[model samples]
Target chain A: MEEAKEGFEPKIIGFTCNWCTYAGADLAGTSRKKYPPNIRIIRLMCSGRLDPMFVLKVLLNGADGVFIGGCHPGECHYIKGNFYARRRIAALRTILKQFGLDDRVRSEWISASEGDKFARVMKEMAEDIKKLGPNPMRDKIL
Target chain B: MKGTELKQEDLEGLFKGLLDKKAVDCLVLPHKVGNNVAYMLVKDGDKIESPAASAIFAPSFGVNAANIVKGWTIPERVGIVAKPCEIRAAIELIKLKQMDKESVLLISADCSGAFTNQDYADHAGEIGDWVDSAKINELKGKGIAIREACAICENRLADVGDIIIERVDGGKVLVAGITDMGDEALSSTELSLEDKDVERQAEKEKIAADAKKEKEELPKMSSVEELEEFLRDCIACKNCRDMCPVCYCKECFFEQPLGKPVGGDLLNLAELRSAIGVPTNQLLYHLTRIYHVCTTCVGCGACEDACPKDIPLTRLYPLIAKKVQEIFEYVPGEDAEEPLPFITYEEEELEDKLR
Candidate 1:
């Protein structure tokens, strides 16, 4: 009985773009779609708008993982904003990895029509986060 | 440092002589902006005028002067008056290939310190009139003279300048040559160089010691949430960008047409906020800014000074810049020969990342 400890459940923070990912999540809800409930969605207007600091902030505050869902490249309502976001977050990921804190951060392309895709991504991300355990940023070593 | 023992008239006479002979194309000097003095380039033999003492210490003056002279392809050699930070910033700019230092002259004054605009307004008693070095020194002994950035800075003497006119040794300014260019300029002037290296070193140590104390006390937010909360007061004013000497982007990301407003859901509002004039990706903008210039940042404290909300943007940049520089073992402005991080990579050095 002592050897049988319960498995861990990861807390994932999803930053969803309002034009696509956020609408996808809303559609998933209205369609009564079933998905992992671990993801807590915070809707932003565009993926480009996410401050790389917010991900670090969320990770430090207690989220095990962060998911940034945005419109596909070239599909942004504001033209090249998502491209800029990609370039920015890509650099941020490199910087975090250099600091030994990159694995917990993830990004995906999702559209307003991709309700099922959103569900699958969330479920998979939750599993990966659970396997990865708590965010290393919480370790206080940095 | 609290009093002006030498009058501006004496300084003007010395500077006028240098300018008349075309000793330098311009003396990047100070002029009265209302009551306060900001940096202004005075061409050959022009009368120097100011209501108050200005910050000639900033390194941007060096860059601005260089940019003006070089960008315009002017044939004349220019002289610049700068603070220690300005000297450092200019040095960084040169290293980044953003500027060429061949035709510019640097003249740095003794830096007691500089006060924030607000500090000057609150303590100096009015903003409409010019506030100069004498007024600042009057408040120095009371621990209310300089800006927080100036207080925390370790460099008092302009390290990269050609000539340094410093007030040392019982208020007597000793003009000395820091480079060959300095020697050439001083060769023309009658100002004597006293062997006061010992005294100058002592002054330097005093500044370094004070800076060390402040540097140690700089807070690093333990949690991401705390950092966010600290930045929550950001009204998204681009004061930090405008005041940044190195943020020389022709057009910024936030100002571009591609930037979008954050979602209505995030604001917890009824509808999406309109996008015009609002900074859509505040964090991204800052990150991109730091990424572009992290190694070149001179920690001028101007960005923080310009912030209406007092977000301590300057404090954060230095911390991040230092980290980036250390990871790459790069000091931004130390020399011209050093290469930037993104421009070069070695297989042996990048093995960890590849694996």
Candidate 2:
């Protein structure tokens, strides 16, 4: 495995839904689960509220990676919010793939009860991103 | 379905008849304006007889006509004669409630492709009376070619219009009514209609296959650096957004004052990036615009035409739209009753696409 740079810790932006992933993240904290402290979380009411533009903005502004956590399929607090999110994110990923930034963005379905899963995903993502190095956009002016 | 075969010379009379018979209060068709063809709203029957009017079959494309008649609710039934792409855009707009379906009649024809406005203006006189049969290869032989978007457009013939006009051999055209409104309008014209099925399926399929080959051969961008280089000349004029028929937002987010940073905020952005590009947010603007219209873009190429930088936007937006539409199994403007992929979703679909 390629080792990360000597002191380069990846900067990740996490968008978590209030009803599920946010609470799950809270659970991870209260339970004292150990994970990397690289992510800055922004809570939204539902996954559907997350526009593809939000991901593009952070990535273009030099975010090393983006993590989107939503309710599991059929378990959305707003009926079909996560289902809609699935399609939007998939479409966004296709666009991202064209720019070779697809791997930098990840989406997952973590329920409020899955505190361990949340912590594990964060750890895994941090390790993968560290090896992948910083976002090329970080050096770009656009 | 019934149709009437009329000579090319008789088309003007037929259009005049529509207005004379009160089938439509006005006609939204291409008209000769100075040296270029432009969409005009003509209400007078005699105006159709003028030599300066009625260039419906001109090998010219300036703007998507759907944008011309958007939100038309004047209660005057307007008959819009348009190419397949414009018709498709109109269908999408109607579904989005941007247009009232009851107030307009869609008249589409098999497109033989068109030259950009600049190209047409430069070669209009040389291209005389051969638009209906101007094949791309043949035009190229004459030292001219159609726009890249038109050359590879698979939807050259639309099956969703209220009325369709098909050009046949022997200088004659077949006009068919695909809907009851079209049928009623045709019956009122007093032109005898007979059972005639337009059989250009083989021809359409050939064009489609050729288009598929062209699409596969298009240059692709696989990195942000490449994309930035490709858009290096962009001035952020937003002409592409302005010409876009589907970008119907009255107040675009990119144009909002809040989105434009100044003074301390601008300095902070520069500091965070170590440096910032002048005329900032070009990438953000384009990415957001593409994502916003990816679902509804009809690939009309108006944005490509309107671009002052000649950015080859058609190579990006339409190509991405094709992939995005395929993922959702949705074709924009294919059917008026079909819901947009963004507005509606199935309970169980695209599971593999999402991880």
Candidate 3:
């Protein structure tokens, strides 16, 4: 895969579970962490409600990468929400691989105390996606 | 208990006896209908003409007779002669509580395979003898291919509890009763079946091996743009969903399309993205339906046959369904006691699936 030109900025869609990941993002903002402003976050109450279709549609609609941040396994405020979401994301990744888009979609556990980790993940994801260049679907579907 | 074996000519008599002996009140099986073979519920003993020999099996992997009997709740037993896949679909429906299992007797005949409805009509018209088990190779030699789903079907034989009927050497119909009820049913008649378990087991192993090889060899859609191009010819017709035995929804979401505003969801999306395709929701409809049926699809390929666009949906669904179903270690219709994977999960399961 050819890398994008210098200064190419990746567009990422972040679906953050409000219980943990949303709080983590908020903590990062308050902490004035240095990270790329590539993600537009959508706050979901729980990761379980993160339907695979939503991730798929957003990716097909041309987002350079999709970032799903959820509560750590067995620590979901809603109990078992992240467990279910884990299974869905895993299944989703396999589907993504079939479409050669596996690298652009990832799930991470970012608790409220992991604000530093949240900022770091975004910066890393943005860099990787930038290297991958624009999503091919960006032209076909959008 | 031993059951007698009868010639191919006696299958009609066996059905007639089932009615006369009051074993079942109404029978659901394929019979001659105009020039085609279709499922019919028959109670009259006189109407039990042997199904066209070729037509009996040619309808397999296409029409799902299980869907025909899905809504039955009566106490009166109904005998259903269906392909093994249909029987499997029926078993899945039974576990879903979608069908009355106690009121039905599953009858499966020997299945070589079936062509699509149009192909079956053309092939049958050309050959003139509905389907002779011996001539199936000859039929294939004439440039007719079996439906894609049938090509990889592993469970072609009826399961242990089914009343399996097959034409063996010398044109003799071998009827086997594997359950107590099936044994009693056969005992009442003048037929018996010996155990051909070793042969059938070998055949099943070969089918499974072939399926594994085929899955590995499939050409997967490798890009979102390629996927969109593959699906671009869709005409928004819901025929595939309609023909799906597993899509047992009472009223589909598309059936009652909600009125849209001047600048609705599609417009909002288009404005955000700069462009969007019209006849919205085809991709959503297909993906949603696949998610819903992945564990219970039975790999029957009826949906593929119903596609008007000639989409190689059979190629798409079975491969994807295999991936999802493997995650659960579940094969739909393979077991009656097995709960659907989506609803039943162990606490320790799918641990590696997470981040």
Candidate 4:
């Protein structure tokens, strides 16, 4: 592992659900919450729409971290969308462990009212990614 | 319940009895037609001969037989003899509602393993009227091997069959009635049966365990680069999807115009990304298919068998599917009555799968 260069900022991609996590991030902004701006948030209508390939593509393309945010279980706006997403995430995590990038991926349930929690999570994730240094995939020759 | 002990040569007699007693109006079995052995629909008991018996114990169009049975909805019961994997496949198709179960009598035979069609021809110069297990084993061990899928097969004993013919001590075979339908079918014949449980289970488990360990130790493609390189030889012929028994979609999602890009779409996609692969969605195609078949795939290795490029699709798709199956604690085709993993959901299930 290499040390993070001075003033080095990690690039993180977050797939957030429009109904919950997206609003939570919005709330965090209005609340004057301070958090790392490393993540480039991609808003989807439902967390279930976050295909496993999206995470895989970003990770393979050298994204330092890939975070997925959705509604809590049984509280999905689409009734059962979050449940399906949960299953897919579990399978993906197990698969990524074998790829040596399981630590690079994480998912959480953030309600719209949990602005403080959202800001805290982003800060924590950004720090974790910084310590992890640049994604090794960025240096691959393939 | 007890079972009848019979000579290996008496399988043909059993089939004849099933047909003669009207247990089944039509019997679907593997028969030698000219040079190629295939599963044929036989109505006449007289036509059930030596080749059918040999082909039953040996692998002969068994998976395809499952697919064939899946399409048929007959009023008269048809007796179909398939190997363990083939029987499991049929049970899956039935669960998918593609096949009607009441119209067919599922018969399974304990299989040591069988060679592929081409391998049998190349290796066994003469597959005589009597297909001997000792001879097959000798050929299987010498240079030429069984099909990769067959070699690593976990379930060679028919676990879902109503009637089973298994190997016993001293070159004898046990033809037993496992279910009510099986016992009734057995009672129709003059062949005496003792309702004893079949042996060879321990042996089958050992073989399966050894195969599973070997498969686990095989090199797997983890990174996207490795997967792309692993599938580099693929010409996108889709012979794998076509031959897969679990892939029963009448209009495949990939085959629709959506997956194939038109001229403008191709140019736009390429321009957006600066550059793109010519045959787009090659990776997407494989991933979507493996995901779709994760719950239903029986690991029969039919896809690899059908691959013209020899992509080792079983190694790629079914292995991942097997992992997914484990996460759900769902074994495809283990029980026909059990619902598919994807369609059914538990409220608090997959708790560990999510954050």
Q: What is the C-alpha DockQ of each candidate?
A: 0.05, 0.68, 0.44, 0.33
Tell me the TM-score of each prediction against the true structure: 0.62, 0.93, 0.85, 0.84
Using DockQ as the measure, which candidate wins? 2
Worst 10 residues of 4 chain B by lDDT: B124-133
- Candidate with best TM-score: 2
Give the per-residue lDDT digits (tens) of candidate 4, residues A1-142. Answer: 5565667688999999999999999999999899999999999988899888787667755788999999877888999888888878877766665445767888989989989989999998888778777777664432
The TM-score that candidate 2 achieves is 0.93
Predicted complex 4: CAPRI docking category: acceptable
As for DockQ, the candidate ahead, 2 or 4, is: 2
Model 4: per-residue lDDT, tens digit, B232-351? 887777888888888888888767766667788778766766666656667667866776677787777778878888787767766777788888898777767798775667778766
Please identify which of the two predictions, 1 or 2, would achieve the higher lDDT against the true structure: 2
Better of 3 and 4 by TM-score: 3
List the pairs of residues colliding in candidate 2: none
Q: Tens digits of per-residue lDDT for model 1 on B1-355?
A: 1112334335565566668766787777755443244566788575665311333322122122333322323457777666656666666555555556666666666565666644554554432222334555556666665665665666766555676666434424455667766676765765554443524677578777977687777775543445445666777677787767766666776676443334543353222322222334554456556666666676667777777887887556765665566556765555445665545543224222211
Question: What docking tier does model 2 reach?
Answer: medium
Candidate 2, position B345, lDDT: 79
Better of 2 and 3 by lDDT: 2
Model 4 stretches with alpha carbons more than 4 Å out: A1-19, A38-66, A77-79, A92-105, A123-142, B1-3, B20-22, B33-36, B59-63, B71-78, B126-141, B179-194, B347-351
Q: Using lDDT, rank the candidates from best to worst.
A: 2, 4, 3, 1
User: How well does candidate 1 match the true structure in TM-score terms?
Assistant: 0.62
User: What is the DockQ score of candidate 4, to 2 decimals?
Assistant: 0.33
